[model samples]
Target: MADKAPSGRILVVDDEASLREVLTIMLQREGYDVETAADGATAQALLRESDFDLIISDIKMPKITGLELLRFVREHAPETMMIMITAFSTSEDAVEAMKLGAFDYITKPFRNDEIRLIVRNALERRALRQENQTLRQELSQRYSFANMVGKSEPMQQVYELISKVAPSKANVLVTGESGTGKELVAKAIHFNSPRRDHPFVPVNCGAIPETLLESELFGHEKGAFTGASGQKAGLFEVANSGTIFLDEIGELPASMQVKLLRVLQEREFRRVGGTKDLPVDVRLIAATNKDLATETKEGRFREDLYYRLNVIHIPLPPLRERSEDIPLLINHFYQSHAGHDVKISDAALRLLLDYPWPGNIRELHNVLERCLVLGSAESIGVDCLPPQVRDAAAGTLLHDLPEDGLDLDAYLAAIERELLLKALERSNNVRTRAAELLKMSFRSIRYRLAKFGLDVDE
Candidate 1:
């Protein structure tokens, strides 16, 4: 087979012409684009002109030294990898070069295999760093505030809270119904916090069995229990210096709740079957759908732990309550999941908005995905929606009338209040826009608002 194309570019700098020629030929044969410079000064000139993945320089050189070049690379092009070459007697200088940020060092009498291995390792490390940086940027963009996707008053309040709390060390408790994107909010907080560069560990408190829950949180020593062949670090350890998201936190049993509270209070934990208590510095972000305060009152959850985790509470609004954001969410989900140019008709959108989404945003995402997959390639009409959603718009005005009959005036007033409140919410509490939505004159809207005791100055 033909020699493969060069995978990385390398610059070779040495005082000896023979060593430079040999290094260049060897690295070239190994499929690297090799450039040669007789001294550190020449190498510096070359570096100023173009980029190289790795630089190999001898410790002793004229005009400038290898250490000087290493310092220059560290200051200007820190991402570029450097390897120092030195005589066996001057190996101490190689150590100094390593301290100055050289990737590694090879002695003058180094073997060909040694040179090749070091070069390959340096290039691989550089590639890994680049990949990690790219991934971090992508994650930062993915979880940014722009991705939250809502303009409703409640959601705007949530956005503001997230921004204010993200910089603090206080634990946050995100409460919302299931499928309300609780975990997404957790991720948003983590990625936006100072701990963004560190790990963001998420564990579902309800998914793991009670038997292994402790070990899973606090790790285990070798032979701690059955199948414990080796020592293990826990999620708390993994999340040290970062944030740990405990989803479905209400599902934590009473025993574990006490232990978790201790961790929160003391900032330390002992591994299962271990004698020593290890300190941790992780920020906790807990989420649950259940009424945790009620759980505390019922004695199902610990009171102290509830208060500890509820230092910064973020209550997410359900989809039905934020119906004004439905159209934006629909477009967001469609652009995310639909790969084709598919459109949704106004009738289909109307039914979607009318349906009470008990499962919230997750349900809407799944429904949109289903529509994109099963509905027509061009557009989605009312017939394309699920039967339940379609039928929501067709439901009877009243399921059954009581035999005694209700007060007509009271019923009509309640209806009016509900529509007025909905219109106000949809218009972000702007009375004039709300009046326009209800198709009522601004003066009439003001009178009704006063009569219902719902008046608020603009």
Candidate 2:
């Protein structure tokens, strides 16, 4: 027999003392920790005191019946599994117990092996359920809004829009430059919404061949196409009761756009070459770097479809526009990369900030990851930065010195102070925003301000 410590605990409830003793002894011998209760009332009290993995109760009991106990367990201990004990005369009641969510039932005078096997199956089922629940929680955390790192006003507004629209059944359009974390925002909305327990399906409309795109979205019956061998469920049907994120929606063919519009209008779609209209309940989220309104006006996209998808619009700011958020994002990526002992010099960080990130947050993340893997020094200096960053940093500060020479430290400090003051003025003395504007972390900017005795509130 396997170890009882790993199998989990069980509760046996019956009015008959001998039957309770027999079941407890049998379960314990089968490598399960066992407890006994004389009646449903005792079982309920025990349940309130301590948790059990499985509950075995008699259908007819004094004070509280087994059906009532099932209700209590369902309401209070939903994670626990329940089984019923009944006689041949009350076998019909056991079927009713099954409808009430009983895991299984064992008749009186049943063989010892039969009862033991039933109990084992119920425990196994409970363990599987608990495992799945834990995985779902981990996935939810991975895609939560906390993973989208930024505190800029632009990001704050984005957060507010997401929170407000996530709970609604409206379609959303996310517009931004490529690599602006549009997919991340889509995942955050899906995981935070009511449909989180269901699937969150994503498909890049541009990646799939135009010939196969229709079948991919709506699926097809066997023999529907040249290579079709089996009936298949489409992304929309797979995402029923959840979310479907269509990336690069602007790249969709005009015919597919019309089909998508029909689905949005009627909440139903016919598969490629299939006659039956299949209904779907899905929260649609579309993303594209293209100016969709312009696309609609130019006849490249359907105007009605564009309006249907643009019901809730979220535009992500380019990284250069949110430069103040760079340092925070760097630190976030550093911690994520497990670079506990690594640090980047302020000079090096400034170089990163000065460069216009055409690729946005995604590019920054990739660069940081590269540094963590390739850079050897504990303190990452300007020399350790990528060639483009280093060259840009050096070229920006190149200048001739006067014959008398210059106070380099004081000269740089004065430039720093002026820039800080301007950033502060622009951000209305919000230190966090000022830090973002200067491409420094909140803590780093605060330290510099305090050193200069310029940490004044407006």
Candidate 3:
């Protein structure tokens, strides 16, 4: 017998005092602290006095039945687990007892093995559920700072910049190519600052129409317009003491830009039909994929508003420029869906790295997910990619290069170097695989590796 067991309290209830004593003694021998009750009313009274981990009760009693005890346990002590015992165990009563929250039902004269197994499994389940909840809480704490996820170098810089400016109450402009997780950065700045726990509203400038933009930002009074139903609070008013993320700020209409600039200069705005000004306390975090500077020069965007929003600028590099980050991002996504038998092959991963990602990180994540859903071989591969990417790879590998009037020897060597690079890439940087593809001995390939500035390890 295993000496070690988890410690918990048990309450035993039976109409017969001898049966109650027997069960209490059995549980106490099994290492559980035990208590006894003569009837359901007594058990209910005991529950009001102190907490117990488990309850074992008889099905039939004169004052209160075990079924009533199960209901009482469910209502009064929801945390405590219960088991029932009965000499006459009908199928419906057994099922009904379970549905009403009895952990298990034991018929008269049950084996000790049956009793031990049921109790052990139920206790283990309770412990396992608590352990799982603790792990999730710890994970959430590590992943979120101001409700944002960023551990890479680019994100570290963003973190520093956000910290520096979030305290000053400056109008911040966040610029990033689309799908670069800019909104996540915005929320982090807002939640980590002093205005945390307040409303943090988000509005898309491009998503809302120009005619309704003013109404959405500054709100409207009852009967303000043709379809006016009642007074509505604007994002600026609702987000008082917090922040508003104005996404795609470059898409704001030129006319609305003047109104936005006025609000930035002063801390107030009037409703659409009301004359009185509404005072607001808001921190603005704006993001755009467009070039606001060029738009300013072209008279499409206001110079004054552009400069105000650019007080603390944060620019996110496109995915191609941050190719080194793919592995990190892949692992992050992997951990989010853990315990699955998922993996990426070296050849498939190398193909992902080599491709110039036009749609950025978002596209990469989508592609990998699709491959997992569609693939049967358990690994993502080059064949899994779309035709456009395959075509691009083919073109790059065979493109004509400048000869520069080199001698025959130099020209041939240059060609060989290019071919070696292509071979290594096709084999996921495996020298042995490259040698097999090139129809050359592995030793011969190694000897020629340094002449072309190629490392066999690469």
- Candidate 2: lDDT over CA atoms? 0.85
* Cand. 3 Cα-lDDT: 0.77
Better of 2 and 3 by lDDT: 2
Best by lDDT: 1
Count residue pairs with overlapping backbones in model 3.
Answer: 0
Residues 94-184 of candidate 2: C-alpha lDDT, one tens digit per residue? 9888998999888877899788778878888999999999998988888787667889899999989988998899999999999999999
Q: What local lDDT does model 1 show for residue 30?
A: 89
- Model 2 clash pairs are 324-436, 324-437
lDDT of 3 by residue, 15-70 (tens): 89988777777777789899998988999999999998888888888798889889
The digit string of per-residue lDDT tens for model 1 on 1-458 reads 95343279999989899999999999988889999999888888898999999999998888799999899888878999999988884577888987888899888688998998888889989999999999998897788765798999999999999999998999999999998889999999998999999999999999999999999999999999999999999999999999999999999998999899999999999999899999999999999999999999998988899999999999999999998898888777666666544566655665676578999998888787777777765676554566567555445346676485644554455456557767888988899999999999999999988765568767
For candidate 2, which ten residues in a row score worst on lDDT? 376-385
- List the global CA lDDT of all models: 0.86, 0.85, 0.77
Candidate 3 positional error at 140, Å? 8.2
Clashes of 2: 2
Using lDDT as the yardstick, the better of models 1 and 3 is 1
The alpha-carbon lDDT assigned to residue 253 of candidate 3 equals 93
Q: What is the lDDT of residue 69 in candidate 2?
A: 94
Clashing pairs for predicted structure model 3, backbone only: none
* TM-score of every prediction relative to native: 0.78, 0.81, 0.57
